[model samples]
Target: MHSIPKHMPTSTVVSASRGRSAQEDPWWVRWTLISLSVLVLSVLVILPIANVFYHAFSNGVAAYWNNLTGDRETLHAIQLTLFVVPIAVCANVIFGVAAAWAITRFRFPGRTILTTMIDLPFAISPVVAGLMFVLLFGAKGYFGPWLQQHNIQILNAWPAIALVTTFVTLPFVARELIPVMEAIGSEEEIAAISLGANGWQMFWRVTIPNIKWGLLYGVILCNARAMGEFGAVYVVCGRVIGKTETMPIRVNTLFEGGTSETYSSSFAVASLLTMLSLVTLFIKIALEHKTQADLKEAAQTHQTE
Candidate 1:
């Protein structure tokens, strides 16, 4: 009787065969899927971005430049976006790092609940988040009377914009860090503590270095979202032309003006946002490659040891 080969298990052989069969699609089917994907991508992404730039510079490059800088409201919207995004990103970074550290390093009750809550923004609509803030701080909201008595403004102000932005971007950093931290495990941290390092030193020296790439990845995503947010900001900001209007809100306002100039200005502002997204994409890709390289090096070092 023939004996079974020692190198390949029965289960492995069966799974390999199954995988091969699954991948054995006809040549036409494979090409058709690839063609469909490219077509869809061109329609959904490539064409829209190209169209924006086309209209933005339809008159001339000078027109696009003038629209971006000549308009006071557009300039203010750009400035407001610059101001708000940093505050939101900083707040989220602090919260994200602390939350990721806790969730990864300890065992406690309600951990699952805490994890779920981190994902709440993704599950819920930004519009709902905006409405929730309005309900709490708007002129006729729950605290509206108290706010009015004190002559304090939350809704329709920069503060409301910042707060809503922070809420919407709350998860990016933590979500990126959690799996990274979990995969790396706590052995290095434990070893550091054992070697007479203090808690802060251990975190700054060991943990931060280990997770820096992931942290940067998360910050990029958070910054992108904070800059591009519309619905939540719109609801709370009340689209007060210059003061509370962000770049996205400015784009919408210009688009609705229903004139050749306004249309050109809108696309010009949109092109700036698109350019930012493209830059972010490039940086994100570079970080991913760096991260994978670090991971591979670590794995190789471990094997040698």
Candidate 2:
């Protein structure tokens, strides 16, 4: 012991040597790599966002303010986006929790097929997604006659927009939840049951807390997609000036030729979408950190137990 063991492990020596080698890299090389990464990020992401802001205010703050405040269509577009985002997010949350719980908590035939079906939206184009709904609800659609009899409006309406948006963004939450639920396992639920917790109690107290971060991550992604949805919403919306147009559609409309719309108006609306994306990024990063911390805490707790 006093001699610190003459036969020290070779593995330890090798690891120390590797660590030293890694730490010995020149400071200039490290800085060069970091600077390169930052430069690339600035070009790919920052530059475009800067361009949007520049164009949005090119005519000055008064024009930008008027584009937002004086435009009824723009206001409706914002309202429509706000409406769809919450509803779509809520629906996806319910579907995600149910689907994830069903898949992870139970074993049954066709489970794989069911999961593949859930991911079909991701595989298909958003335009195709809109087309599917159109076929189901259009005037000549399968339920078209029934819907007509019932005086139901789906195509070129808010209903169609919501439905198509839902279809396109359906996979996010369930996809996020499946892996998390699998890793956490059923042991906690079993234990909670043994301790006299009911189904709802066990889920609310044990499962929800563990999966909340992943769920939040999924919801954020879903919300972003729902709000930014263009192809599907555009297809089904019929671009009704103020009734069914969302922020994306509004931005697109603003740039159409033969219209009185200016580049500033279009870019101004676009900046809103860009800002939403930035906000989503911020939330996602924060949630990722929180998720990592929770995972570490859970691991430590499990080890202690």
Best by TM-score: 1
| lDDT of each residue in 1-305, candidate 2, tens digit only | 35445689767876897888955668899899999999999999899999999998888899888988789989999999898878888898999999999999999999999899999999999998888888999999999999999998989988888888888899999999998887677888999999999999999999999999999999999999999999999888988897889999988888883444555788989988988999999999999998777777767766777
Q: Can you write out model 1's per-residue Cα lDDT over 1-305, one digit (the tens) per residue?
A: 14658776788877896788875788899899999999999999999989988988898988889999999999999999999999999999999999999999999999999999999998879999999999999888999999999999888999899999999999999999997887777888999999999999999999999989989999999999999999999889988887889999999999999998898899999999998898899999999997777677667756776
State the number of backbone clashes in model 2.
0
Error of 1 at 249 (Å): 0.4
Query: What's the lDDT for all of these models?
Result: 0.92, 0.89
Off by over 4 Å in 2: 1-36, 257-261, 299-305
lDDT, model 1, position 63: 86
Ten residues in sequence with the least summed lDDT for candidate 1: 1-10
Off by over 4 Å in 1: 1-22, 294-305
lDDT of 1: 0.92
